[model samples]
Target: MRIIVYGTLRRKQGNSHWMTNGQWLGDHLIDGYELFSLGHYPGVVEGTGQVYCEVYRIDASTLGELDALRSKGGEYKRQLLQTPYGSAWLYVYQRSVAGRQRIESGDWLKRDAVSE
Candidate 1:
């Protein structure tokens, strides 16, 4: 299976260590969703805007590890989304983003750059 990571789990970001054994598929854009800042990490909520993501092919065990890292169904919920690469599971924010900053460019690192 494959998963789409849009936040801290992408490449060189913090917590990316969890994805060390997975195969990198490439960058992908998830449509009809938005990214928001939640301090250290970013969240993807169903809305309007392209969400930049990285695809990784992983096994059941790797997925399980990621689920644990993401808090599975608590702070984030897993959802299957269609991207240019294919269908992949994404961790969507389960809480309200009421006061958080929205990442208009859909790129977490780009948003971080603007903040800096």
Candidate 2:
């Protein structure tokens, strides 16, 4: 399965190890979504903005591991969205974002640029 990752799962990030067996299909910008700083990591939810993401082709076993990491039924919900790599799974934030800092820049890596 293909997946779009925008936060810790991105290249060189803390949690990217989870994608060790996946292939990087390049980066892409996805619209109609908003990124928020969920502390050390980030979360994306469907909204009015866009987000920078890395597309990957992962196997079923990898998908299962990712689902568990994202807390598939709790903190996030996996949904299929269009990407340059074709339809891919995106982890949409499911909890209230109230009081959280919005990564206005959309790109999680460049999130610091927003306030700089």
Candidate 3:
């Protein structure tokens, strides 16, 4: 299965282990979506315009390992998303925050940039 990854997973020296072993399918943009940081990883949400990120094709067996690393049962959940490249699953935060402003896709900031 293919997965769209953003944030730390996008960086070469970070949590990008999946990319080294998995098939790199190049980068693509997901329209009507935006990226947000949820502590350790990033969450992609439905928004306006296009959200850009890299994608990887991994074996289905690896899903279990990925789920554990992402704490799938807790804060994050995998959801199906349609991007310009194709369809894939992405991990996103499940908890809701009232009045939390959804940033535009073009203005979606990266965690590393914020720290810098």
Candidate 4:
């Protein structure tokens, strides 16, 4: 299976260590979604814009760990999205993004370059 990560799980980010077991497949833009700043991390929801993400080929164990970390059924939900690498899992935010700062640039790595 594969997963699309846009925030801390990306290369050189804080939580990237968790992706050590996965294969790096490069970054890509996913349409029909939006990225937002959730304090130290980020949350992506189905919307009208696009998000920058890194696609990775992962194993079952890594997927399980990621699910636990994302709070699968609570804060985020795993959804199958069509990527350049074919169908992959994307963690969609479940809670309301009211008042949350949106990362208009859609790229978490370059998030600091743009302001809401």
Which is the leading candidate under lDDT?
4
Deviation in angstroms for 25 in model 2? 0.6
TM-score of each: 0.92, 0.94, 0.72, 0.94
Error of 2 at 23 (Å): 0.6
Ranking by lDDT: 4, 2, 1, 3
Off by over 4 Å in 1: none
lDDT of each: 0.89, 0.92, 0.65, 0.92
Could you give the C-alpha RMSD of every candidate to the true structure, in order shown?
2.0, 1.3, 3.7, 1.6
lDDT of each residue in 63-116, candidate 3, tens digit only: 667778776558678888776557777876666633454434433334344332
lDDT of 1 by residue, 29-92 (tens): 8889999999988999999899989999889999998889787559988998776667889999
**lDDT (Cα, tens digit) per residue for candidate 2, span 12-105:** 8989998899999989999999999999989898899999999999999999999888975699999999887899999999999999999998
Model 3 spans with C-alpha error above 4 angstroms = 11-13, 97-116
lDDT of 3: 0.65
Superior candidate under lDDT, 1 versus 4 = 4
CA shift of 105, model 4, Å: 0.3
How much RMSD separates candidate 3 from the native structure?
Answer: 3.7
lDDT of 4 by residue, 1-116 (tens): 99999999999999999899999987889999999999999999989999999999999999999999998569999999888888899999999999999999999888889464
| Count of clashing residue pairs in every prediction | 0, 0, 0, 0
